[model samples]
Structure formats: structure tokens, C-alpha cells
Target: MMKAKTRKPKAKSKGKETPKQIAKKLEGIGDGMVADIKKGKDPSFKTQLRGRSNVEFDEDRGILTLGDKETTRNFLNIGHARKFMQTTMVAAKTRDYLNQNKTASIREVYYELKHTVPNSKENTFDGQTESDAVIVDLEHSVNTIREKLNLHANPKGTLYGDITLKDKMHHNDKFNCAKLGRGGWSVMSRLEPEEIEIVSVNAKYVLVIETEAMYERLVEEQFAKKNHCILVSTGGQAARGTRRLINRLNSEKKLPVIVFTDGDPYGWYIYSVIKQGSMALAAHSQYLACPEAQYVGMTLHDVETYGLENVTERMKDGDIKRAKEMLEYPWFKNKLWQNQLKKAIREKIRIEQQALANKSLEFVATEYLPKKIKEKDFLP
Candidate 1:
């Protein structure tokens, strides 16, 4: 049996590799291609093939990770030539970003590299998708994240609660999420330890809410302040940045993570992605997934226990299909999850977090959440 890889706790300020160090790695890749050309061999770029088929769920660790499958982009092959060229261009531009100590969004990187090819009418890249794919290719090949290469995606999600952090890279600002009031601190896309520092946490646990409306309701009720927990709003499916922040908080601060979502397959899946890592970005799961996270709300049982069936929506065909699919996933193989999935499929009913408002606006913040958490009521 293959032994599972054990990850170490990340240091509070494990700064990223310097620009020169990253450029050296990029240069090695270029040098290899040059040596291949000198030896009259086909120059190829090899990287782990990304997607569902090339990923494996590590049951012990509860994270989807890249499997051993790999694909090569060979320069001599007609089909692979275009991609190979695009990948080379992306690597060179990323080296530039590193050497210049500059940062850019994925979109910015695409535009910066887009131009007419010399002595040809064809453009270097047709769209951002091509560049984006190559960037990920570089990431897996180099065994580093894009943030180290001074690249980032657009930021999403919001955080509110009793946490204080410092931004060392830009403006050197230190702020507390609690003091930010209603707006809360925007979770930055580049939340790597080097950029953001977690100074102190005055919370018992972190509550990640799936919807913005529900998050707002809790905030209005001063849920975080009263319960002494950090509140994170994913808005919908969590972006990579949001997940990473949650992972860091859970791992570094040693705080428990509790997820609240609608009582439906889609919402449950969102919680799953947060806890076990998604296949699309599985390569970086060690730094992103929070395996310790537990589902806290919107269960089918809650629909009955809280008298919420009156406000529950009938499940759609897609929802039922998703629920059935979850029953087979290794991570969802537990009896608790199996019963929930079976019940969801049989009942064909889904409840939203907002349905708690049927009782009262403050019901969730004051009663439902407190009671559930106190009783250690959670779905594995």
C-alpha cells in the first residue's frame, strides 16, 4: 500500500522563494529544451495531467490529489506544438514577473503576453484560457504555486470576526476583522503566509457560511461577537483564496472549523470541497483543504426538527442526482452521510439556510446555531 503523505504545520511566516530562485527554476526548464535541440531530440514539456481522471481521493487524508498520470507537450508534434509554444511564452513571462518583483492577475498576464507573432499574422494567444492553462502547467511542473511567481486570480469572499492580521507585502497595514464592522475584511486572493500574517485570534472556532445573505443575517445579529467565532462568507462556491484562508486559520490557529450551508446536495458539496479539496485544484490541496471541518447546519433532520418542512423547496432532478452521486464518493462513505444522502433522495426536499427565518430573523444566530454547536450536532 502507498503510504499517505503527512504534511507539516506551516510556519507563521514562511516567506516565498525569491525572484532569482524562481527564475533559476524557469531557466532550468528552458535549458533542458535547448539541450534537447542540441542533441537533435524532440523537446517536450511534461506535467501531471490535470482533471477528474488524473486525480485520486486520498481517503485517509480526506483530500483529492493528483495521480501519477502525466501528459507531454512535444514541440515536434503538430497538435502539441501550439500548446508547447504557449507554455514556453507563459514561462518566460512568469520569469519576468519574478525578476521584476511584480504581481499580476491571470488576466493581466494574458494581455501582457498577447501580441502578433513575428513574421506571422497569427496571434501568440487566442484567449486567456490558453495562458491560464499554461500557468497551471508551470505551477505543477515547478512544484510551486502561482503566488510565488507573482501571479494571482481575482479575490472573492469576506471575513468577519475576532481575528487580527497584518499585511506585510503591501502597505504594512495591521487590522482586526472585528473592528471592520459590517463590511468586514475582504479575503485577498494572495493569502499565502508570506503576504498575510495571522497575529491573534480571539475566537473559539471559525464558521464558514455558504451564502452571503445568511452571512449578512448572522453579522446583523452579531453572531460572531456573541459566540466568539470567526465568520467567513464564501458567497457561493468558495474561491481558492477563500479556501486557503480557512485552511490557514484552522491549521495555524488550531481552531475548529464549522461549515453552514443550505440543506441540499449543492450546498453539501460546497462543504465537501472545503473539507476534502476539489479535483480541479487538487495539486495544491495540502495548502487549501481543511479536513477537520464539520458540517453544522441545513441538514434534512433539521428540516423536521425545526419545523422547516413548510419552507423547504422540492428537490430538482439535478439535486437528486447529485445526492445519489455523493453516496458513492469515498469521502462521503460514512453512515451519517449515507443516511443523509438517502433521506435527501427519498424525501426530495431541500431547505435553505434562510428558511430558519421562518421562525424569526435572530433564530439562527441566537438559537439554531448555538444549540447545534453546543450539542456537538454535526454531519461527518
Candidate 2:
């Protein structure tokens, strides 16, 4: 029987930032500039240039690691000139936001800074994409995510579980995913560790689902209670909040994480993002990536094992391209992953998690899950 599920503690958000800490961070940027001037050195801000060259697949850790190649965006260099100015400006603005205890989205940041630069004719930012990239740069430089700077992405995921959360956004009134009628907590917002308190976590493992339909079906069936696990769904690509929550569970709550997705390149990439960290946000890997998480999937072999070939669909061009790229990455160079990719490319077929629908909605919970868990058939 499902245990009586209820959120016990009152939830309250704490520590977006106090005035003192925010002021200090803002002042530090100014001080760094002043010291550079005093030392007769060019005022510069150093940050890692984020790209393929800077990111490498770590075979041992099974994650993408950032390289030590650094770029000093100084007021003197031709290229570094504008970036240096932008860095300080963004830092100052972020500190201001934190000091005010106000939050903004990536889009909001672009609008706020979209005015013409004081000295230069070009507007602060021509597009949201530009500001978004700058926010990532800020994250890399400051060793903090944009959320702490009071900036958030449009939320994109949901979670359901026996675990309870005390959010800083809420008044610390505790809430559990199981109690949320349906939909649980819409995790579109960022999951800042300092902001959310995991008041209670009786669940044993975290089951991350890629499809919303599957997540809903499982929730309807009371799968979390039946299996003693938390269910999370990232509508498509798992967002930062979803990924961060998984990391916290693995690192702090010590909950084993199992990722369930379709048997395709896209599904594989989703699993990669959860386990090894996203290449775009590689700088925040430690906070966002759950390296210990395992992929318990709809692997290509599952096509035969579950007798799902008829339900499989043909692979698309984009799918083939992505699979090729993943094949080159060292983190996925292992024989198991290589064989799966090769099978997909050669067969030109991909399976969706939904295909298992033929077997019945509860087929995943009642059949796939138990067998995978018992056999330890997770993709490492």
C-alpha cells in the first residue's frame, strides 16, 4: 500500500542573497579594476572561452571536463576590449539584482541591458541570444550559475515523489510532489541549492523520465509509491533545475538515479546531459551534472529483448548526425555505447519510449523496470 504522503514542514525560501554579500561581490569587481590601474596593468577580466577546444571527454570520470585554456579580456586587446567591458557591466548588474533580492529571466536581462552603450554606438545587446551567451560567460567567470544572480531560464520540467521541498520562493510551507494533485512542482525555475530545502526524502531512488506522457502514466499508477522511487520528467531536454535536483539527490540525499528514455540518439543525448553534463554548461558541471546516475533505458538491444522492432521507427538524418558526434566523444567510446550507436546507424532505426505503449501503459513500471533493476542492466 502507498504510505500516507504529505509535506510535513513549512516551506520558506532563504538566501537569494543578503545585502552584505551582494554588496561585497559588486565591490570586488570594482576593486579588481582599481588594483589593476594602481599596478599600471591593463584592467581585464579573465574567463575560460567555452567551446569544443576547451571541453574534453574524460574517460576516467566519464564526463566532459573543461580545459585550463583561459582568455584575458583586457581593455587593451582588440577582441578582449569589448568583452572586458561587457563582463564588468554584467557583473555589476547581477550584483545589483542580488542586492535588491530581485529575480530576472534570461530574456529580462537582455531587455534591461539592451540600451546603447555609453561610449560605443552599438546597443548593449541586439538580441536575447547574445545576452544569454553572456550570462553563461558570467557563470563560467564567477563560478556561479545565473540563477544566483537572480536570473532564470523559462522553466521546463516537473517532478513527483515522496520527497518534500521547502522553497525560498514559497513561505517555507512544505510541499511534496505526491500531494500536488497532479503536475507536482513545475520545475521551470532554476533549482538553487541555497533556496530549496529537501525537508524529507523517504524515497529510495530517483527515476528520471524523458517523456511527459510516461511520467504522467507512472504517477497515475502510483508508481513512486509502488516502486519506492521519485519520478522526474524533463519534457524534452532535462533543464538545469531538473538536473541540479538529481545531482543534489545523488550527492546529498545519496539517492541512486536511474534515467529512462527512448532508444534513439536524442534520448541518448538526454541521458548524457543528465549523467556527464551538457557541453554548453560544462563550466557548471559539478553543480548541474549527476555523474553517478545510470541510464536504464530502452537501449537498441532492448528492441530485440522486449520484441519491440515493429514499434520502432526509422532514424532521421538529424538523429544519424547526432549519433556520429556522440560516437567521437571519448566518454562514450566504450564498447557498449559504440555497439548501440553502430546498430542505430546501420539499421537506420530508433525506438521511442512511447513504443512500449503496445505492451500496456504500466508495462514500463510492471515489466521493464523490475527486469532492468534486477539484472542491473543499466548503461554505464
Candidate 3:
């Protein structure tokens, strides 16, 4: 009997993978499965299982990461066959999209691939959820993001700053965020370096706000101009694009990131997701998480110091429950957060970023932020 030759997987690129690269990786998976079948082996592949149990927070790196808990999905296994088939279908569709230089939403991919299996009554996909899960599986299997495969989620978040951006993949136009009027530049879902270029930055720091209302207030007050900083609004929780932009501005442009959010457990969780990574997306934390980011406001301590106690809202059961749960998180186990959570749970109260309006609309942009930054008063 002759020994079979073994092949090592190719090394992935440092940042974003090109469409060609993505297509090659997709093909590699198919080829590997074919090779396995020909070699009299199970046609199977492994993917890191994702969930709370499989996520670990790296103390040194200050980011969440997926642990080495991989599960093999075999084409011959009944439990894994549906998902394996779905995953391959998604990969095939994604490769077609890449070859044609076309982009589609995850929803579009689901619809495009939805059909009744040949000689079978079962549908390839019952809904978008099944297809969406398989897309993520294919991403993990290929060691690349869906964006690289010519797919994207809905775009969210906004940015207003004295920065210029070049859209190399689309318009090939250079535009300044400052001149975009009050609406600001809509942060697109695909901000991969190859797609969008951060041409120039003339800012000192980046202010990531949790809400759009606060973002608009800062823009209206010319906060970015006066402070010489960038204003990024995550809408609510920071999306992958917003987080990646924040990471790029901090790491590449040498700008410090400060997050401002409502003084509630949910809002603080948003800040945590920005500064640290979330369990769901831990695999891409190095690309999306800004661990160096600081939290600068809406702290429970701020209510009394700033005389905004009257505006504080009573904490609901959910808020109190969340606050307690956060205390157990390794990242949130610091002295500052310890005091904040204990106080919030004890006091049964929460506050919003908008509560600062009691002082004045410009107070946050002018007084609060400047004082905090100057004193280096930020929670870890």
C-alpha cells in the first residue's frame, strides 16, 4: 500500500481577505472534503463551537477569544448532515458572489439559496436563521469573514469628524467627514481597509457614544471641531463596523478612544462590548474590539457629583439583575466597576446620557468631556 500525501493549509492574510483569496479558501474546503472521500475517510470538517462556555477572556490582551472547543461535522452523520449541506451551499453561493464582484445581504443569500432538494420534500433552508448560521459556519471553516465573501449585514452607526476617507472599492472618491453636513458619514458595514481607506486624520481622540441622540447633540454643538476630536455614534450597541473603525482610528491613527453611554447596566454592557469583545463574536475580537478604549461618563458616581440625581430613573428588576451579573465578569471585576455596580444595585437607580441635558445640551460636549479627559478620569 502507498502512503497518501498530506497538505498543510495556507496561511491567511493579516487583515481583510480579497475576493480572490476568499474564493480560493472556499474552493480549498470543497477540495479537502473531496480528498477525504477519495481517501476512504469521513467527509468532515471542524469548526470552533461558539457559546458562553467556549469563550474565554484574555487578561493580557483584554479581549474575548474562542477557546479550542471544536466539533466535527461529518457528511455521513444524520445530526450534522443538514448543517454540512447548508454550509456548503452558502459557500458555493458566496463564491459565485465573489466571482461576479457582487455583494448581497445575508438575507439575500438565504433567499437565493432557498429551494426544495432534488427528489426530496425537505427544503434546503426553512428560514433565514438556518442559512445565517451556516454562513457563520462557512466563515469559521474558511478562516475569513463574510464581508470578504461578498456578503454584509445591514449598515449602522455614524461618524462626524475632521477626517478624510477614500472609498477605493466603490466611488474611488476622497471625502471629508467634516463637510458632510449634520447627517455625518454613515459608517458602512464593510469598512475593510481594502474597501475604505482612512486617508487622513486630524483629531486627538475618538468619542464613541452609545446613542444617536447624543451624537446629534455633539454634532449640533460643533463638538468635533471645537475639541478637535472624532465623534462616533454606535446607535446603541456598537456594531462590528463601528467597533472596527474605532479600533483602526485608535491603532492606526494613534487616536485614543473614549466611550460614553447611559448610566445603566445595559449601557455599560455596550461599553464593555466596545472595549472588550462579546462572546458571540469573540473569534473576530482582534479585528473589532478596542481594548484600549476608555469609559468616560454616565457613571453612577456622576449623578451626585453633577447634581443630576433628580433626573435618575428607578432601576427595574432587569437592570438590577444585569448589574449583579456583570460583577461576576472578569473584565468588570475592577475597583471602579465594582463600586459602580454595587452602588447601582444598592441604590436601585439608573441614569441616561441625556440626563446631562438638565445641565444644558452643550454641557456634555463642553464641560463634562473636557474635564474628564483633562483629569484622565475614566473607568477601566
Candidate closest to the true structure, highest TM-score? 3
Window of ten residues with lowest summed lDDT in model 3: 1-10
The model with the greater TM-score, 1 or 2, is 1
- Per-residue accuracy of model 1 over 1-380 as CA lDDT, tens digit each: 22233344334232356668888889889999999999999999989998777777776677777777888889999999988999998899889888887889999989998999989998989999989999999988887878888899888899998899999987989999999879899998889887899999999999999999998999999999899999999988998789989999999999999999999999999999999887778887777899999999789999889888699999999999989888878788889999999999999999999999999999998999999999999998
Q: CA shift at 276, candidate 3, in angstroms?
A: 1.0
Using lDDT, give the best candidate's number. 1
Q: Please, what is the TM-score per model?
A: 0.93, 0.90, 0.94
Scored against the true structure, residue 1 in model 3 reaches a CA lDDT of 12
Q: What C-alpha lDDT does candidate 2 achieve relative to the native structure?
A: 0.80
Q: Which residue ranges in model 2 land beyond 4 Å of their true spot?
A: 1-23, 35-41, 118-120
The positional error of residue 82 in candidate 3, measured at the CA in angstroms, is 0.5
Sliding window of 10 residues with minimal summed lDDT for model 2: 1-10
In model 3, pairs of residues that clash are none
**CA lDDT scores, all candidates in order:** 0.88, 0.80, 0.87
Q: Tell me the TM-score of model 1.
A: 0.93
